[model samples]
Target: MAKAKVTDEQIIQVGSELQKADKNVTGHALCKVLGGRPDRLIEVWEKHLLESNSDENSLQYIQLSAGLEELFQSMSNDILKSIKSVLATCEQNILTQADKHVENEKVACAERVSALREQLNDANDIINQNQDQIDSLLKENQIINNKYQKTIELEKSVVELSTKLEGYTTAIKDKERIITEQAARIESINAA
Candidate 1:
């Protein structure tokens, strides 16, 4: 086909104005305004219009089915991986915190045991001190008992000595009386 003498810019411009006015760019109508062969101009313009509309539609409604599906799948995988990583980190933190808590509890138990041991030792010391006091009191009691025994023995000796002195005094008085009687008898015989 011979290249149409009519410019594409003119055809598109008039066509846009006609479309805006809600008029059809028919062969007779465009031919009357642009002074071209109606059939040739309309045919060429229609072909160009069809090709441009095709390109415009391609731009307006892009063919993204395959690319978008791939992108969505990749994003889903990335999100899943991120979530798994976050959950793993949280689990690790929880375990570490639990271990720390267990260690703290063990330390607390150790401290309590140490304190209890100290208390036990103190109690034992107090008991030992009381036992020592009891031993000292017993020794003092034994000493007092020994002193009382000696006192009792001394009293018995004093009573025995007093009894012996009384016996000796009575015998001496009896001897003196016997000597007086014998002397009186001798004097009576001399008188006779």
Candidate 2:
């Protein structure tokens, strides 16, 4: 005997009604409900199962996407915090180094100023000593000049005394000549 042909719509409707009734919609159950070949019902039931599972998979994909988005936001926040911490630490380090550099410069400047003052004091002392030596030399030079002037005056006196002695010698010679002539005349008279 030839089997009755069930329509595709009728099979699909029966499968849906069985599912709504909370009954197993297997090929054997459809065959009993619709009096059709199990093979035909099995094909339609598998198609419906594939469609339902596809819808569930799409919902799960949406949920998974939302979860991934939340995770991405959390990670970004963590990265930003870490960057801020690093920047703050770098800023603090730069400030500390700058302070140290300023302190070092101040110390160096102070030392240089102190050294310059010491050099200035030494120069002043040297200048004072040179001035003292110049003063002593000037006094010695004045004494030598005074002694030279005294010697020149004494030489002038000696020259004047020698000229007076020469004049006296000439007068003495003239007196002796006159006395010799007088003594000669006296002897001649006595003889006569």
Candidate 3:
């Protein structure tokens, strides 16, 4: 006898039912339920497994995004603290220089003040650069969040499609039962 044709819908239905029953949805089990070649059933099973794995991978991506955001926040906080400490030390040095009494020391203090001003300018540049970097990181984080939201939406769509498939499967089964009952009635009348 020729092999029976198995539709993707039937395979999906069988897989869903097997999963609902908490049974192992292996190729062998699917073959017994579906009556197709073991190899073909295994291929279908592998495809299903891949789709599930993709969803799991998406979840991992979301977790990684969260971890990265936390790390960026920590780094930004540390940079801010370092900047504050540097500013405090600079202010203290300026105050100490102003307390000097000797004329020669006063001239030296003037030169030191100029050098400190240059250093302050350089520090401001660094702060500005760091701020730009933080802004860029924030933008990247926003992009990642958007991608995560899109992934969530895609997952929701998949669930909706599965629900619709189940409904269609039920309708097909009901029609089949009706056809079988009608055939039986026709046979009984012919026999009578």
Regions of model 2 farther than 4 Å from truth: 1-67, 176-192
lDDT of 1: 0.87
lDDT of 1 by residue, 1-192 (tens): 687678878877877788789998888888878878888768867987899889988886665699897997799999999999999999999999999999999999999999999999999999999999999999999999999999899889888888888887887778777777878888898889
Can you list the residue pairs that collide in candidate 3? none
CA lDDT, every model vs. true structure: 0.87, 0.89, 0.89
Off by over 4 Å in 3: 1-103, 187-192
The TM-score of candidate 3 is 0.41
Structural similarity to truth (TM-score) of each candidate:
0.48, 0.54, 0.41
lDDT of 3 at 129: 100
Better of 1 and 3 by lDDT: 3
Alpha-carbon RMSD, each predicted model: 25.5, 26.0, 53.8
Q: Quick one: best TM-score, which candidate?
A: 2
User: Local error of candidate 2 at 13, Å?
Assistant: 62
